[model samples]
Target: MGVTLTDSAAKHVANFLQKRGKGIGLRLGVRTSGCSGMAYKLEFVDEVNEDDLIFETSGVKVVVDAKSLPYLEGMELDFAREGLNEGFKFNNPNVKDQCGCGESFNV
Candidate 1:
């Protein structure tokens, strides 16, 4: 399994890319930080890297570096609006525990 994006997520990304007019896709990765020791990082990719694993979902490419694949595999990204708050949400199966603020996780 690999990373995926919900319809809402794909649409949101596509709209952003269109306005920015220079991105190849979205990049997902991990970093060593946060209380749970791991945090998710997302960025707009202008080019693909040789070691990156690319997953296409709903016509949008989600790129992950080789090192982050193990942790991000099978994850589904979603865009949601709840009352006054709205943003991307990660549904990660590999996560075992998450911090109170929901910004980091342990696997």
Candidate 2:
């Protein structure tokens, strides 16, 4: 399994990249932080390292570094709007626990 973006998420990223005018894809990774010990990080990629792994879905590229792959494998990212607030949501099957605020998780 590999990382993927839902249709809405892909559309959002693609639109942002078009507006920015330069990006090869979105980078998805994990960092050690938060109460649960891990948090997701996302950024638009201008360059991909040679060892990076890329997964394409819905016309968008989801890139991951080798070290982050195990934790992010099979995760699906989604964009949702609830009232006036909107953000990306992580649907990670490997996660076994999440912080109360929902910003971090542990597997």
TM for every model, in the order presented, reads 0.98, 0.98
Off by over 4 Å in 1: none
How many steric clashes between backbone atoms does each model show? Answer: 0, 0
Clashes of 1: 0
lDDT (tens digit, per residue) of candidate 2 on 10-57: 999999999999999999999999999999999999999998999999
Q: Cα lDDT for residue 69, model 2? A: 94
**Consecutive 10-residue window with the lowest summed lDDT within model 2:** 66-75
Model 2's TM-score against the true structure: 0.98
RMSD of each: 0.5, 0.6
Query: Model 1 lDDT vs. the true structure?
Result: 0.96
lDDT assessment of candidate 2 = 0.95
| Candidate 1 C-alpha lDDT tens digits along 70-90 | 999899999999999999999
